[model samples]
Target: MIPEDHFGSDAVATNRMHSAGVALEELLVTAQKQDCLTVGIYESAKLLIADPDSVVLCVLAVDNEEDVALQIHFTLLQAFCCDNGITILRVFGVRRLQRLLRGEGANRNLEEHGDFHCMLVTNPQADHCRLQEVDTYCQESRRMDQWIPELSLQER
Candidate 1:
């Protein structure tokens, strides 16, 4: 696995490995607690435009091995989120996201179309602490003008 600092010191506020692990764990926990998490480009785009206030974070995956067009699409998504003041994080690929969403291990099989290029984490529930933590992380990241990591299709 790539070191957490490979992203940047701002990626995770804490230096502890467990804390970094907790960030991902907390994210999944928050996702499970709500119905606001949306997977897929179309659904995520709609959430970005129609309910910007509810969007907590936008996680983009480099899963499509097609061509640069897929990369362009993700760039556009990032621009949209940036313009809308939404926090965006680029992960390795769809498998990683699917694993998190499904609460499965690396050996688990991924369902077709279960792979999403963009996932919008929303806060429709409004009372969860984990979601609040996500929001806070995004807000702080924005304030520092730093992104967690920018994983490109070629990077995987």
Candidate 2:
């Protein structure tokens, strides 16, 4: 069996870079639907540690860099989510996640610098749009053991 420590290897990082774009579109859509989302590694980790039950899903944007440190960071975050029984999804590149989280028409000047590498989507209020849909999707996806995006033929 492959060892957990090997996730930081160049081979694994290269492999992850190749397949990382598959689910980005879907992840962006789901992220926009959440009204209660926490951005940045610190905020996301805090929610995961303090209130795992309230976190609906975690979407980590991995940097597709040659740096092994970045890979290790993502791996550790994924492992923590798994241990906490929280469903986590991963996509390559923090740019996509940062733009999506900024939301459409949001004032760029008012926003914090988009340096965060991960985000945690928490349970939304009842009045939020598509809250039920996202929640159901997260639960079903986790139960099915499907973490990566399953793109259709046209999406490829």
Candidate 3:
């Protein structure tokens, strides 16, 4: 983490430094260790949605250390947060997740049929053009896990 004193409250910031894939992967692993099953990928979100009481925490792997696709992916997560059905966490890499999790090492609380379903996105570019609102975006994002994006937008 960068030193807090180095930043200005009024300034907008972007993470331009490209650390090896290790950092983001480490964070993912850490979050997972706390509630190991809190992560979801594939049809997992849909399955979680099926249960009225379940709270889905989504961690989207948008890169693999080559570079970070922060902005657009953040936009998508923002969209998910605005939606009632899912929660999104944008973590950078996938591999070191195990190590990071093991380092944090905590257990998750889940009922029967409860678990974290992590989808490691190795090829983010494959879905970029296909990811937008309407015919794209969540629709395509969920397809990786064999799911259809369930959008809930109705006139008030």
Best candidate, lDDT-wise? 1
- What TM-score do all the candidates reach, one by one? 0.63, 0.56, 0.33
lDDT of each: 0.62, 0.57, 0.37
Worst 10 residues of 1 by lDDT: 104-113
Q: lDDT at 99 for candidate 2?
A: 59
Cα RMSD (Å) per model?
6.7, 9.3, 15.5
- Global CA lDDT of candidate 1, please? 0.62
How does model 1 score by TM-score?
A: 0.63
Q: 1-156, model 3: which lDDT tens digit per residue?
A: 877766853142122112212333433443343332444343444544454234334445433434344444445444654475553434433333433343433332222222222432222223222112222334343565725332211111
The alpha-carbon lDDT assigned to residue 73 of candidate 3 equals 44
Model 2: ten consecutive residues of lowest lDDT? 147-156
Per-prediction count of colliding residue pairs?
0, 0, 5
In candidate 3, position 70 carries an lDDT of 41
Q: What is model 3's C-alpha RMSD?
A: 15.5
Give the TM-score (vs. native) of candidate 2: 0.56
Error of 3 at 142 (Å): 21
Q: Where does candidate 3 stray beyond 4 Å?
A: 1-36, 65-82, 104-156
Which of 1 and 2 is ahead in TM-score? 1
lDDT of 2 by residue, 1-156 (tens): 888678667576444433334334444445445345667776677777788877766676655657687667767878887787766665555665555556575435317756456767666343334444444544555566776422111122
